[model samples]
Target: MMLLPEGSFDFALQDVLNRNDHFQSVTEGDACVGKVASLLLYVEPVMADSGCLQVLQRFVSDETLQAVAIVDDKHNAVGIIDRGKISDIFLRPFSRDLLGKKAISEIMDKQPIVVDIKTGIDDVARIIIDSGVRHMVNGFIIHDRGVYVGMATGLSLLKEITHRKQRELFIMAHYDLLTGLPNRLLFKDRLLQACQNAKRLGHLLALIFVDVDRFKAINDSMGHAFGDKLLQNIASRLAASVRQSDTVARLGGDEFVIVLQNVKSSQDVCGIVGDIAEQLRQPIPIYEREIHVTTSMGIALYQDYQDSAEELVRKADIAMYEVKQRGRNGYLLYAPDMEQQDDIRMSLETQLRMAIDGGELSLYYQPQVDLKQNCMIGVEALLRWNHPNLGSISPAVFIPIAEETGLIIPIGEWALKQAVQQHLEWIAQGLPPLRVAVNISAVQFQADGFADKVRRIVADSGIDPAYLELELTESGVMSRAELAIKTLTDLRALGVKLAIDDFGTGYSSLSYLRRFPIDRIKIDQSFVRDIHNTPANEAIVKAIIALGDSLGLEMLAEGVENQQELAWIMSHHCREAQGYHFAKALSPADLRSWYAQSIVIKCP
Candidate 1:
């Protein structure tokens, strides 16, 4: 608690503190605030006994309150023992005579800085902070009725300021910084408190974590800061929309948490949650942009699966993820069955982990063909998990769960290694050294040493660095630019290729694509799924291909389910395509056979 000089990061502390738009206020030579018309009458007992020392003792004792003693024979107040003087005097030495002190005139301070009652707390806080004093003295200095009122200290004001700042900072930390409301941190704290309360009161504390579905689309179409301000504006409305006791927190990105306190039944959680969903159904205007987002809420209550806050948060987070799985804009209360869903998904995650350990996980390549040249230019390495009991689990079910649970690190690594090795084998067999593209999840990409992992894998596999390819989502690229740049640079250095996967469905700033060291972009399947039917889909697809073409980056079409889709892709001059049309991710041996047994395009 002590801001000791040794452990201090003096100047750095300011950056830790949030700045205000307006400056703080100040009032000089203000009257010492008093409760009574008569000031001296209050201090009469102290003056009669030990005037100056009594005031000094009282002032230093309470860091928050400030006071001064006026001393003189005629009570003309020749000098005063203000807070600073008293603090200094108290720090000097302890004395028994401090009690028997005569008139305050002997030890009172003559002049002291005082702020008026109208002075802003910010200005008052700054003075004491700048002065290095624990407290700032404030109030009416001269008595209106000749009776001196009590003084307020810088320490007290400072403590109050610091406490409030801590709360505000905590709000910014865990909650939405833009909204000035409870953030994820606050939600976590509240969830923890709820768990404790639930145990004590034997009541159910329901944790419903909500994510704004397609929120990124809104933010991407608009702007992020605007997205932030929109979040802030809606957060207050959301708070007002809910019950006074219920807690709503923005959990960063588009995710949010609502802790329903003292729930006796699932109905209680649902009824309020239904109302919360209704409130957010309307569109929010961000500048001239009318932005829209829907909520997918996952609900979990305390004492169900967890007795603690972290468990509650984890369960709620899991449930929230389920809501997204079931399709956004709906609420799914935490069901015991949901754990089954998590278990099945986690079983796959666990299996993926074990697969790596058991050597059951392998990577299969889908050749990326240059339809024009009719040659396999690159191969996208698709991950395959062959479980002992379950056989083959679908990536559709597990990939997301892996990404969410952060199991993708090891799994992605396994895939990366396999891809590099496969590319190396093709080259060793005198086959064309086509680029081997491996998918990188946002979590895996964000991980520290991800680039290094790729470097290590390429080196270990003895593959040409340029033949290794990394595929990422558009949003994935923008999430952490500095880190992404580092990752891409390292891979690009290895002569590895970096491709943006499912390109259109992200909050990508076109400027960022230029910023990132990306070499290719694969149009998402949804845009390509019915690109022929939907003008929007076709337009989006064409624009992306054009953008990639103009950037001189290779463009690949995903989810080419039919010949018509393939013909359209080929006509558009897309360099490559992958989906159910070419082949769903196949088995390693099957993939090799599919590539090898068929017509092998002769290299030039």
Candidate 2:
């Protein structure tokens, strides 16, 4: 309905406007997000008996008024007047003059779509759509207890619904569904915000990267359902471990991140980290099982805003990997040297690529002796690298890099070829035949057609496969025992002698020992280092020797560097041993001389 004279409608408007504050309160709260009252606009209502000129004057005074309510003497809503219709009517030549004096009810909509203020915005929107799109031009009257209260426009309704949908979409995109924590996208955003806050407040920001240790193993063994429950439990504990100002986020899988703002010092971070570690150490009950998990955390601090959010996260990730490398279940602060070490590792990996082609790599022979016979029985071939610029690089440092880079396969092939050729040369020189042991890395062993490659190498060498011994780490074979079993069987079929290297240091299980096809168990150096004094080492060595005896396999003690260590293995009935005490890894010439001397001593 058209508006009445300002003075005439003022009385009705005042009566309805008195309830506007209550309507405002309902619209602003969370519970009323989709309620019709949220879209209510309090426009002065016109008296039903007023003239069209009075409505015209009221529209002129309030330029933003989209529509007006027509109410009766009791303030009951009767009809609605749209601004568009009135403007159209009055704009036609002298139509306003002819119709402006008529009663506003004569031209107004007698039955407008009036919705109760309590109705949902969706319901009212549906009503508008079903009634016709024309109803949106003038909107509709909103009332309470049959009394006209306000008008709700189509524009405001659309915006409110759109805003709510956007909020829902935002939550879905930014949060992890399972853990209900910020995912990587949102974590980066929060980290940037935290960094800004820290910079503004002139305080330190600590970025912590957390990785659940051996999570894949647990996930594979316990089933995905149990793994999911464990992750949720961990998420809850991690959230509880921090303050309200801090943010804990899951970067997917078992990786989580945390941002701590206003950190006072490294000690403050240490205390928080210690608490987190302790919290994670507690057993989590899932599926009637008390599951235990340990985390490796790496913390990178922004003291002077030197690192961006991304750089901070990267540095923390690098530090976390360091913890994994050293051993799992601990934390490491991001040190400058750690980054430097990472750079060096990357550089070494690049250099190793050229190493095989550049002839920088070679093999050295360390003699394995028969302790009782006091004579050499075999030699273990170790890979050595002499970089053109860097004098010598330990296999301990470069082998892992090669494994990670997939460079180990070619390098391993090279070593196998060289060792076999060297053995053939020794035989050609009329030296006594001895088993030449060459170590095989896990990646090179598990590679497709590995056995076939070994067969090809053995055939090409024209040397007896009996003289070639392949030394595999205990953990390397035991990690995937079934695959290893098949591979070992294939190698055994080729008549190559097999030995388990570094025994008693990794998955030392009797089950795999019975299942695997062959030969010797080499006691790791750690067990042999102080075997006479350390009961644990002595016990481990004795157990290995006994296990080898039971399996009808030879037992060789590695790292026998002293008379006491050598005497201890000999007393334990270990027949073979190798270490610096016997002779260091030597060149072919030195090994030939040492072999001749060893034969003379044994014969004498």
Candidate 3:
């Protein structure tokens, strides 16, 4: 077999072959065979001793005669010649006269790249790039079982490879690797285009920002691989929930942006947002367990906002953060006033940091009374911040900010140390020993070496560990139940009492609750506030009391504001109660004075 450059073929013979039914049918087996056979020329090869002048004459006669094959007497391919080498020799002064009349084989390329006729177009492209030849004047030879078929051009193969590379580059730039959804770059481009269209057509467009709530917690607890799979699942659901005209894009890590074009009104946007939220809320099965997640969506209307695409997205982001602040699993529309509220929150966050350092934060104690004995037995330490300018700031306002900023870890530690030290001081003053319960933030509880830190603080405080009670919320304990069990057990070994606060608010598995080494459970105030009027609250409170009794753990009801509620709690066998019905949270000095003067004194 021999490689030969592309050459002009006899026009009459090519027409005859084109008209032949056999040739056309034979080419139908594999449509992708873009090889030398498809452009073959039937020109016969000259012998090694053939006149170079004659070959040059033939090349001059045929404009397409770029190269020709050389063969032995037995019809075996040996070498090839191209128009380039012939022109190089002839163009030099006196060189053509010296070498043009010699054998064409003298100037022929003896070794050339060859491939099978059935080789894929892709493989042929790779061969063209790998070969050092700038132009295959003598094109690559295609063979079938050692028989020469035809020649293939380097230009054609390179064009196909360039086209394929362009396509791949496009996909890489526009789509996310993990979710296969449009990435932020493409989303922004599409959002800009959609805004332009909406403005031109006088239609409403809504840009909805969807953020998965507590996704970092999920990712940290379940591992990133599972988190990636969860994102993919979420992307698919979002895609299925929207129309083909709408664009859903992943803005990296638990955040997706959707552009709803041609929306009728805010109501239409609301309906779509609701559907998307519901779709995301559906349980996604991961690693044999169903993982549940909810999305907080923020919608910004194009005409209503009258802003640039980037600004609209920013507004939507602000709204999404507002949803997160109001307790996630819902959607909110962007309002002008929300930005002001955000500024206030930022100011509060700044002031809070200063408060922590300036000793403006103090612990207020709320008495937890032993209702059965009609006496106070313990006090829950609640944190309070009094800013120099803003006066008393509610924990409900600053606590979430602290948690988000990770200041909760230090704040929690301070609260625990202060409560323990205060308890020790009371003991030194000859007062009865009482348990001092301090609420532990989830961040502080899950922190590395937290149990060890608590142990160190307790040892340093010189207070009996039994008097230092740590109150962990139900969601905090159940987030990582197995890990919580280990941590709780370690704290239990330190001799500090452990209790689950805001018990009925979260979904805590009973089996894990049993496994946790808890000394008591505090009924959340929401259930305890209207226990007399709301049958559901009454039943839940009763059930929790019974559950505590069955598990040999004490039950305490919070938010007891009147005799009726206290009577109802005591009637249901609740051992302890805490709320304004007895006394509100008081300063350390005021609490000491109140406890001294109070007629209700109980001993265990």
Task: Give the clash count for each candidate.
Answer: 28, 2, 1
lDDT of each: 0.66, 0.84, 0.81
Question: Per-residue CA lDDT of candidate 1, range 1-604, in tens?
Answer: 5554532422433433446521121112235321112222233313523655556667657675445545344443334455565566556655436634565555655554344444555554455456543233432243334433444443444454555456545444554545656766667777677677778788877777777665554465346887787677667667886677878877777666777777778887788888888878766776765544568888876755345677667777778878866645688766667778876765666666666689877776776776777666777787777778878877787777666556777788777777777767766766667777788887777676777887777667677677777788876667556557777787787787788888888778777778788888888889998777788988998899889978889888888899888888888888778777766666556766666765646447
Q: Which candidate, 1 or 3, would have the higher lDDT against the true structure?
A: 3
Estimate TM-scores for all models: 0.60, 0.64, 0.80
Ranking by TM-score: 3, 2, 1
Candidate 3 C-alpha lDDT tens digits along 378-445: 99999999888889988888998888778998999889889888898888887799889999998789
- Candidate 2 per-residue C-alpha lDDT over 250-285 given as tens digits, one digit per residue, 9 for 90 to 100: 998999999998888999998999899999988889
The model with the greatest TM-score is: 3
Give the C-alpha lDDT of model 1.
0.66
Error of 1 at 52 (Å): 19
Best by lDDT: 2
